[model samples]
Target: MADISLLYPKGKEVSTMTLTEESINDLSVDYIVESLTKDIYEKNSIKKILTNLTCDIDVINYRADVFEDILNFPELRDGLVELLKKLEDLRELEKFNKDGDASSLWQLINRLREIDGYVLCITMLKNILNTIPIKSQGLLDLKQTIEDIYNNGGFDILKKDIDETMAKAQNLKSVTIGVNLDSVLKPKNAGVISLNNFEITNSGILKNFMGFTGSKEELNSDEKVLSSHKLHPANPSLTRMKFGSAQQGANTNVHIDTSGSATGDDPLSQSLKKVVTDILKRMVKSIKATLQKYVNISGYSLVGLMPEIIFYIRFAELVDKMKEKNLPVCKPLAVPDDRVAYGEDIYNIKLAIKRTKGEEFDIIGNDITFDDEQRIYVMTGPNRGGKTTFTQAVGHCFLLAQAGIYVPATKFNYSPVDNIYTHFPADENDTVDLGRLGEESKRLSDIFKVATDKSLLLLNESLATTNVAEGVFIAKDVIKAMAYLGVRSVFNTHMHELAHHLDEYNSDDSYRSKVQSLVTGMKDGHRSFKCEIAPPQGVSYAKDIAEKYGVTYDQIKKNIDNR
Candidate 1:
């Protein structure tokens, strides 16, 4: 359980099923994730959330609201990011407590420190939220919880007790020792002594030993006890006592012991160890008593939200980056029940990422309007004319829009799709198992079995690996299925004949959305990469390629004359 969930709405269980890898690859989803999560902290965790993206309308709307709040109020996002940075690993605490492993006093102290950090984080965030405005419903709930916890009388009392206990623990800075030893360098007894502001200096001892030869008025006070022998007359004087030195001659080895603390943690005498242990025992008991009441609070549960916080912050950063470049990004309006999707000035987001990485290029955005009239599009264009790029762009727009982040478009509005099905070209290895055409047909069949009228299908150069006659024959049937199924689709292909026969499929009245031909255009005999609602210009495409390579009749004649 998380203290705050930025991804999900309160009390809503996110569905488990997600778009398949085939669909993700067809839409270039992995590329999108990589681009968004770049330069983000805990990037792996962020990627996990992105990889498991949901297509649920409510979930998407929930995320969109949270992202909107973050984008609107940057200070709040920054504060939350900073607060999340202080959270220690909660799993470690759970594991330690689960095993009841308090074998050492240091472990107990560390646990207490972690708890103290959590309390401080919560209190500081509560105070900071007072100045920052939060609009998201989920965040408002979290804020209310924090306020309630802080205003409760029991919480204030517990906090005060913790502060006082820590102050006492901090005051126990140094320990004094009293040791009793036998004649054989063995300890018999030891105890902690009250430590004063004891100073070891030369002049103080000398002044006490040889009283100052000053005026009689200065010496009239009580005489100081100069020697230990005088102070303890009954005990024998051991002022000149000398112990055996560990130093050996020139050939002797003097290995330095580099381990243990300077405070005699690994003392050579057992009596000294006993004294340190006694102090630690007392300190641990006091700390345990202070923390006992707060142990079950599960404050570490807050750390579980660190990764989610990073996810939102990182995407917000990318949104800012897109804004800095003067690119168009808009908040999408989701109409889940409408069963229609459309966007104006929609551009390929993957291209935007490349351009941001210093790739020099210009982008021309295309507008799409899919409704009951034109529900499926048979897109055809010349090679390298951005047919696949444009198709993938539509899918990317939907994914980004529903994720609640700013999409790379000027305007976007769409109904949420229940799922996305893709029929891109198969991998080379897939052909080994079932030849290219067989595999493509099988995958298409699989998609139809799962896809519904509310699904989105993106097909890129599908069914073109076989001969033209065979390809067109199979593509015609596929287009018929799309029309009858009434799903939104972009079937970009080299088979211009298939795109030319859209009227044959649209004549059927039972079809929910009419099929239309969408061609990638040419301007001034150059590839424009601009998609338009028109018939495929196959003859024009061939002529442009011939003239570009000096293969036209006039160009060939001129080349021969020059030679």
Candidate 2:
């Protein structure tokens, strides 16, 4: 028997889908590239982008390989590493020299030098360390040692040793003629015997009295006698002992054993050995310290370059794939100066739209320069002739230009609008039950709530479903309100009577300069339009649009002919 309630707890169960790791990785990469391109395209810091890209690629590749436990993916690692190297090379080029021309190359060279030095050393160490094999107790012991050292501030000790060793080596290079000692020994008979004045030679020792011979060089005549003396009685009567010199003319070749009981058990040989060992240890520590410092510095430096490096690598890969498929590569066209200048001048868009389906897309000409003067533009155009598209294009262009991307026009001149508010083609299902008009009113209200004098408002057929008179009244009031608030607005409507009404209102000297109309083309086959700030002339294209929507043009012509 099954319990139905227990089988599905909480009455109902909903299954949710989540993005897989691969999908998330791809999205992350895309986001990184997009964000980097948007942020750094005009900064000329291409190297930074490349560095970031390479770092991300390395991280992803490493993660994938680890999770899959596949060590044979050398190609994956190599490709990423190669891209990183290239970016690193480029970054180096930027910091090479201080002189103008030479400086660029020097900058690159310097950066490469630093990166190569740090990367090579650290990678070599990691590879070497990873190759060590140990089993059971030995492995555990080694692991514990490493953990203890790393976790308990062992680096500081190593760092100090390194500093001391380097300094000692630098001092040692200038000195010569140091005393030599063999093994230091202590005995009750001869307190502490110093093994000094002994010469080690390849042909065995030529010392006095007790010389021992062997196939290999053993204790020489002088070293043997000295050894014997340390084992002798430590009384003052046995003050000195002597041995022969391997070299005949050298007086310092004879070994001397001294029983200085006051010297304690410390041997000269032991002290020298400790000094030398300490020096060597210090040297090793210094090298490690330098390498660690390099890692720290380079890690921080590479962080800044990650974004660009990642993007370029991906973009290059994309380009390569496209080429392999023999596909056309998309290239951005050069932005025109007129557009940039127009963008500098206008507070509002007169008419701005990109290429739309079945529409001949060209930006209309108008001296739409709005500084502190003439900020509002009320446009009346036929439906299906591009009112919404134009508004969107204008807003998009401004955004793109400000973001340092190319605008879609021969020329652009406009002011820098603080914000761009749009009310166009929203999802009907997403709208509240109060209707599209109500939703639009709310959107407009929100816009007004946040909009400032420097803000731009783009309204497209905003109250179209309402009565024409009410719509016109609302539009007029909106425009008037915007004007009073010193905010710029571009209103697109089909109210022909509203144009006349605007004309009447403009007849007053006060409102004349504030309001203006730039009419879009009527139904014409020319596929081009002109814009001017004057009272609209010629017949309105509203009825034509209505007829076109209701019946085919050919049918309309036939009906006309039959009539």
Give Cα distance to truth, residue 157, candidate 2, Å.
Answer: 23
- Tens digits of per-residue lDDT for model 1, 1-563: 26467788888887734778898777776676687656544667775666565767787877888888888788887788778656644444545555442344545555665666667877877976777777777677778878887888877777787678666655544444433334642333444444323322323322432353345664434323221111111112222223222211111111111111122222222223333444567677888888888877656677777777777777887777777777788888787655687788888888878877778788888998888788889998889999988998888877777677778888888887777788888889888878999899999999999888888899999888748888888899988998898889999988888877877999988877689899998777789999899988889988988888879999999989999
- Estimate the lDDT of model 2: 0.41
Model 2 C-alpha lDDT per residue in residues 407-498, reported as the tens digit of each score: 44445544444556666544688566867767767777777887766566677767775477777777677776676666666677766555
Question: Measured by TM-score, how close is model 2 to the native structure?
Answer: 0.41
Model 1 residue runs over 4 Å out of place are 1-3, 38-41, 88-107, 167-279, 558-563
Which stretches in model 2 have alpha-carbon errors above 4 Å? 1-288, 300-302, 305-367, 371-373, 503-513, 523-529, 534-539, 542-563
C-alpha RMSD (angstroms) for model 1: 9.7
lDDT of 2 at 247: 20
Error of 2 at 119 (Å): 7.7
Q: Cα deviation in Å at residue 65, candidate 1?
A: 2.1
